[model samples]
Target: MIIAIVGATGTGKSDLSVSLARRWGERGLRCEVVNADAMQLYRGMTIGTAKLSIAQRQGVPHHLVDVLDVVDEASVARFQADARAAIDGIIERGAVPMLVGGSGLYLAAVLTDFRFPGTDPELRAHWEAELQRLGPADLHAVLADRDPAAAAAIGPHNGRRIVRALEVGDLTGEPFSAGLAARETPWRPYRQFSLELDRPRLVARLDERVRGMWRDGLLDEVRALLPLGLERGVTASRAIGYAQAIAQLRGELDESEAIAQTQALTRRYARRQVSWFRRDPSIEAMDAAADDLAAQVDRRVAAELVDTMGG
Candidate 1:
């Protein structure tokens, strides 16, 4: 059986995955961990993304983490394809595949079997040229006219998403939201689980984590990447911590101001993630902050897997 562990950042999803993998291993069940976080795909982005260490993995096999160059544009379609292949391989080997991370859109695309409007190289080129000339807000306005629903769903400040929506509409003659809504869910192949926490406690944890990130030299991480000449819209540059740090480095703000701004943005993102997962009835949510999380998971997973094993 396949299982998914999902939650907002700082919710201890990875810790739970590691604990479960070790428990299942003791039971002589084969399992592998697959990453679903978008930023974790980039190499040299370890600390900023909170990527798993070799020791932290505890010899459990992991797939699809740190597999991309910082400059590479890793699309959701690419992520879906890679994850599908990994899932198939794990099942073929009689192992359980556990997908774990906080990237809501990426997780939704894979679990729902959402198909993008086919890409047109020529059309994509045209849109890229137009984006360069017109800038993001103008392009976003155009998309708002063509696909108001998509425009509403995507933040206007998120230029990459705005550009993508316009490009998809140009290629498919349909809105991006329409394509997403039309797709059927494919998660029947897996049993999904979600990690949740008390709202006040979660917010407090998020604040503390952001402060810890700053103390751990998040600015230095961004400074190291600055020499790479990374562009503004690349996925890594837009990461919650990286974006604010870059602004500070560029003299747009002081370090204290940057930290405050980054923390605020992260808090907002976490709220959205919580809302998204809450809407999905399929997720079996568990209190991640509880002292007995492993016991709770064990009870639930045992019941579900009993049926899978036909016992």
Candidate 2:
């Protein structure tokens, strides 16, 4: 059985996961945390991403956090593949895999056994060249013409998806959306849960968290990472805190304005998370702010594990 704790940034997902993992360990049930947040994957992004420290991990092993260089791109498809392998390893060791973090798409990809279209190296190279000259909007327009359904499904601002769709279409001689639709589930069935909080309370918590991040040198962390020279919209630079901090560093905004903007963005992101997770019926949603959250999750997981053992 897998317990996935998911919510927007600063929603106590990590804290809850850590507490649960430690609790399970005391119960002689081995447990490990597998990161599902995209931003937390990068090295040197600790404070901004609220990555768990070794001490905070409380000797419970964690997977996929701080495992990538800032320059490397960690895709949702890559995360799904790696996380599945990690889950299998944990289960083999008689351990429960606890999927944790706020990256809804990443969690969905793993939990639903969603398969992504395969990339063509040659086609990717060609598109890379074209992207330099044609720009993202042009590429997105091309995708819109070829696969309007896919274009509508993907965020217009998401250049990576737009480029991948066009590349897949060019390589396979079929619509990119068609390729995605043809993909198959790549994982065995697993039980999952989603941690939720009241919208107003979540937003208020996000505001406080963002303020704390600024006070705790989130700006400095971003500044330290700027020398890595990652381009805008690249995986690392596009992270929520990094993007807003870069604006301040670039003289586009002052410190106060940057903090305010970052807080607003975080609140908006939390809202989007609520919307996304609400659509998935498979997610056993529970109010994470409740005092008895761990007990509730334990009961849910214990019941499911009993059924799995019986089967």
Candidate 3:
């Protein structure tokens, strides 16, 4: 079965994935990870993203990580296709596929009956140009009029998403949120878990993690990626710590300001993730701070597998 380990950032999702894979291996059931984190899909975005190195992964095979260039736009539709293919391939090899990440939307794309509408390049370009001309707030006002639900959900600050919402609405002549509607039925046989942590504790952990990213030389990583078109990258350049690092590199923000801003944004993003996943009733919640999280999740998976077999 497809197993999803999801939560907000700094919730130890990656560590749990590796731990489960190792434990499953000990029991002679092969398990591999398929990354559902959007930023982790890009190569060379390691330190800021908290991506585990090859050594840290402890030889557990991972797919869909480091498969994209920084310059490439990260499309949810494209990722949905790639991630499903990877999961099917792993299942074909008689291994369990673990979908691991805090990216709630990405996880939903795989785990739910999510569908994507066809895109019209001309409509997309029109919305993108409108976003560039009018800015996110003004463009979002336009979306609010066209599809109030989408506008409320997307908010005024996210220009890229605003553009997509408008594009989808104009293209399909329906509310953008309608395109995101998913049935309760999953696309695959899956067991899902969402790690839960109290906001104060999670905020503290996320702030420290942001500081750790800077301590680990996020600026240096951004510098290394700049030559590889990181600055020109539509998606990569806007990543939380990476964006702050770029601002620091350009002398627009001091080191302290950059780090502080990144910490704040990371916490905000984490809240959004929690809200997104909280809407899904199928994901079982597990305390992220629990000492026996991995073992607990493993037992749940084992029970599910047995139940599947008995049926």
Candidate 4:
């Protein structure tokens, strides 16, 4: 059986995945992790992305981690094919594939048979050039006027996707949302779980998490990645803490200001993640901060996997 662990950031989703994997391993069940987190795909992104080291992983095999350089674009289409292939191989080997991360769209792309509209190179380049000249907010305004719903769905911060939306708009002369509202059955069936925490408590934890990343040498990690062309990478450059930390390094923000901005921005992003995952009725919610959270998740996943295997 395949399992997906999802939820908002700072909700202990990663820890719970390790807990369940350890528990299942002790029970003689073989399982491995396939990451759905977009940022963790880059190498040398450990401290900021909270990527586990080999020692921390405790022999649990992980796929799709560190598979991309900072220079590579993270394409959901590519991930969908790669992850599904991994899941299929794991199932064939009689081992379960545990997909984990808070990247809702990437998770959906892997779990569901979502398709993207066609792209034109020249049209895309035109929009991207406009993005460079006018910036994401201005380009986003153009999309808002052309297709407000699409603009709303694709946030202004996501310049790559904003470019795609405009390209689709130019090509189709239709609202990009029309393509999104269409859906189909998932690539494979699995039990999906999401973690939840109280807003106040989550905020506190998020603040600590941001501080922890910095304490763990996020500045050093970013400094190392800079030589690897991190700033030139469109997607990698804007990652939550990475962007602010880069600003700090560039003398745009002091260390304290960068940390504060990262914390606040992360909280807002987490809210968006919750909104994205909650819209899917298939995901079962679980208490992330509960003392018995690990056991509770184990029990549910245990029962579901048994029934699935038997059937």
- Work out the TM-score per prediction: 0.88, 0.84, 0.95, 0.92
Order of all candidates by lDDT, from best down to worst?
3, 4, 1, 2
In model 4, the runs with Cα more than 4 Å from the true position are: 145-149, 172-174, 182-184
Candidates, ranked, TM-score:
3, 4, 1, 2
Model 4's number of clashes is 0
By TM-score, who's the top model here?
A: 3
Highest lDDT, which number? Answer: 3
- The digit string of per-residue lDDT tens for model 1 on 85-167 reads 89888777777788899887788777776777677778777777877888877877888888987776564566777778887
2 against 3, candidate with superior TM-score: 3
Clashing pairs in 3: none
Q: Give the TM-score of candidate 3.
A: 0.95
> Which 10-residue window of candidate 2 scores lowest in summed lDDT?
179-188
**Selected candidate, larger lDDT, 1 vs 4:** 4
lDDT of each: 0.79, 0.77, 0.88, 0.85
**Residue-level lDDT tens digits of model 2 in 1-311:** 67788866776888888888877678677788999998888888987788889999989899998878888888888998898899889888877888998777788777665667678888888877777778777877777888986775554556776778788787778786663342244355665667777778878878888888889998888877777764443788777777878888889989888888888877777776777666556667777778967777887677666455343
lDDT of 4 by residue, 132-196 (tens): 99999999999999998778767777889888888988898888766555434666877789998
Residue range with the least summed lDDT across 10 consecutive positions in model 1? 179-188
RMSD vs true structure, all candidates: 2.7, 3.3, 1.7, 2.0
TM-score (C-alpha, index-matched) for candidate 4: 0.92
lDDT of 4: 0.85
Q: How many backbone clashes does candidate 3 have?
A: 0
